[model samples]
Target: MSERTLLVIGAGGHGKAVAEAALLSGEWQRIAFADDRWPALCETFGWPVVSDVAGLAALEIQVAGAIAAVGNNAVREQWVEAIRAAGLPLITVVHPRACVSAAATIGEGSAIMALAMVGVDAAIGEGAIVNASATVDHDVSLGDFAHLGVGVHLAGGVVVGARAWLQAGCSAGYRVAVADGVICAPGTVLVVD
Candidate 1:
């Protein structure tokens, strides 16, 4: 609605996906990528690669907000911090096709991709990622930088700790608690163990 521009850090696969989702959201008037590979990697998904990580300072006046589109949780957190320190607001990106309940809370710098379902009262922490086709049921709590890979499903009331990663096709049953920094393999199914 306003004259807002988004600077997405990271020009890799995850970054491209985030940028595409952001574009589909139609929330930003302009969007650009800033990666360490800037000059060598001039563009991604038809978007210009404007600057590198070190160049972020110069972009403070150019972009209204930013988001780290990195797949690595720890790296994303670091980029988010840098974006914050640069006085750029961290924005949440949700694809138009994603079914996110109005009661759900999506944190700053988080990205919810196409076909993802974020249920009522679900809490998505800062810099988190709900990748394509992921399903987070009601009352699920995802900590900061947590990543739910494509097709991953978390049943109701699941609590996933910070930096936890549930790889593709993984499924967790109701009320399951995943500790911080845990990395669940693809297709992994969690019971109430």
Candidate 2:
């Protein structure tokens, strides 16, 4: 394949993690950032802050694809739409160390971080995030823009709705159905009685 350059939208902590995972995946030969902060935030982990949305317009010819690294689900979804509207391909980043079953389906623009485990038949939607060390059991469904923070655990058959944020260390019981836009506090546990 040709040398692919990935444009990461957002230059904050989450952006760094996404870029690092992309780097570890060895899918992109080049990576850069495009944040709203632009000039004031010139660099992130040594990668240049190419530009904001305006800069992205100029970079259309150079970047192979783009991924929204924003932490907020709504914001990320917006960026994803913008990137698509701009005619840039959305890229998915999966860390090499992540254990994803072959039967699992990871959607476009999603990120599966290092040490994350996605079991058989699990479906992760577009722009969703499975952070480091999270465990998604078999048959689980994570909706578009959903986020599973570090160490989050979801038992088999769990269905997380779109834009749901399961904070770090949160654990959900079997067949749990988390509603859309729900935000679970860190360490929260959802046990079905």
Candidate 3:
């Protein structure tokens, strides 16, 4: 794969992880970032943080694609829409160690991190983030921009709403419903009655 210029939207921890993955993949060069937080650090993982999202309009650079690296699904969705409106392509990042089933469907600009497992027939929506060691079980449907933090476990047939964030080590029971924009903190146990 030829090297491409990529932009990572969001400068948070998740964004950093995505950058790391992209670097390790060796398929992208000239990785830059756009975040709402202004005057922030100029670089992360040795890659320059060029400008805020709004600043992209003024730059003379050409970005081949972008990744919504925000941990919040809603924010991810918003950024994805904005990038799309700007005519930038959305790219997906899957860590080398992640295991995705043949029947699983991952949308554009989504990232499946190291040790994550996307099971059979699962559908991960666009711009979603499945963080390190997360497990998305069989038949699970994750809406657009949903984020699964490190070690998050979604049982079989669970439905996750758009832009939802299940934090580290969180677990949802089988067939559970995680509403949109919901933030589940780390180690939270979700039991479906």
**lDDT per prediction?**
0.92, 0.92, 0.86
lDDT of 1 at 91: 90
lDDT at residue 76 of model 3 (Cα atoms): 75
Cα displacement (Å) at residue 102, model 2 = 0.5
- TM-score, prediction 3: 0.90
Q: By the TM-score metric, which is better: model 2 or model 3? A: 2
Error of 2 at 160 (Å): 0.4
TM-score of each: 0.96, 0.96, 0.90
Tens-digit lDDT track of model 2 for 18-55 = 89888878888778899999888888898889889656
Flag the better candidate by lDDT, 1 or 3.
1
Q: Per-residue lDDT for 156 in model 3? A: 99
Q: What's the candidate order when arranged by decreasing TM-score?
A: 2, 1, 3
Ranking 2 against 3 by lDDT, winner: 2
The number of the candidate with the highest lDDT is 2
Compute the lDDT for candidate 2: 0.92
